[model samples]
Target: MDGAGSGVWNDGSVHVDDQVGQGVSADLAAFLRNADDDRPVKIVSSVCGECGGRVFVVLVDDVEGGAERVCTGCGGRAFIADSAEFWGEADPGEAGCPCGGGEFETAVTFSLAADGPVRWVTVGLRCEQDGLCGIYVDWKIDYGPTDHLLALA
Candidate 1:
């Protein structure tokens, strides 16, 4: 239950199964690109007076989108976007990249997990920024409702 609210799951369970099938290639490609690169990316904090929480991932190849939700009042991690009752946070930068910042050297780990005969895929992300800062992004997917949009900022 520790990562339950960190964009790691949709069905309130630890297992997520959405990144399978044809989409797996793209997801894996993105993951690999993120893991192999060492570049400084910007993460827009929801509680940092930027209106809402917007997560932006940067790598040596390209930039991708990410999201993080927390309880509006308590600041506790909110598993579902609707569960938090607050969605005002929006990105103020250009298409997936921050406004004005030089890309710094950074490296990240992108992992995928699948279980049983279903071969479901869940993405786990950990990044090191400029060899000084470090953070992780954990996420899960649900195939029942295949409209998962955690990667969208």
Candidate 2:
């Protein structure tokens, strides 16, 4: 949280505490550290209905529309009707990792700005077993995760 929403470190990662993606993701984590208690992030560990799979979800926002997810098992796709519900975990534990094998490795750096006007955030998870890989879309209908982040300022 040294330089939230600011510069980059020697390693090339953002200066913000990467608490959500580990200890090294974005300034969102630094903001989350000071987030309001009333508006806590709503996180869920959903079991894939098609394959009975547990996942560590990374959200992806579709600027044109809603949220989407690709199943790790059946390759089935699921969409969250609300695009704002999904938010990154400040602690960003390993439990959300879709890959159950050998510790989930980063398939990609899920950024909060990828959604453009929609401002959707997406994180990637890769599983060594069956190569289970996918993202979790923040589909919360009640509130905007991005808005909440902005409010933190």
Candidate 3:
């Protein structure tokens, strides 16, 4: 991907390529590009388990130590604490826009294997106060039929 803030990282097992400022679709492309590789991957659901709604309002407050994905249809919620380790070891502890906003609007993308299991997951965050965008977290999933993993998102 040729873009101002595009980059690719390959560590022999995992390959991540992303472009900043290109929106969620681009981020999803980055994750999908490596889906067929032999490396393990993970996924987060867009479908709400409660009402099967695909729409969600995501919120993340790193400083306050909270994050969640709320389904708009049934007001169902999935919390970060529910899948803490699935979020990986990295923390967006002080991550914020230059405008100093701590809140963010979140979007998630998943990479799936040809066999229907998820291979990877990417979480993209945009500053709710200033419109700044960047990736927040991403991790590979080694275990799943994907149903359990989807419910976690």
The digit string of per-residue lDDT tens for model 2 on 118-150 reads: 232333344445554444222222334444332
**Each candidate: what lDDT?**
0.26, 0.33, 0.49
* Candidate 1, poorest ten consecutive residues by summed lDDT: 39-48
Clashing pairs in 3: 41-119, 41-141, 42-119, 42-120, 42-141
| Candidate 1: tens digits of C-alpha lDDT, residues 1-153 | 222122222232222421212112223223333442232211111221233322223321111223333223343343221212222432312112122332211112222322222112222222212222222232333333322322221
What is the TM-score ranking, best to worst? 3, 2, 1
Give candidate 3 regions above 4 Å deviation: 1-77, 80-82, 85-94
The TM-score that candidate 3 achieves is: 0.46
Number of the candidate with higher TM-score, 1 or 3: 3
Measured with C-alpha atoms, the lDDT of residue 137 in candidate 2 is 25
The numbered model that scores best in TM-score is 3
Model 3, range 10-73, lDDT digits (tens) per residue?
4443534321222333434343434434533332324556887654456554432334666667
What TM-score do all the candidates reach, one by one?
A: 0.21, 0.31, 0.46
Global local distance difference test of model 1: 0.26
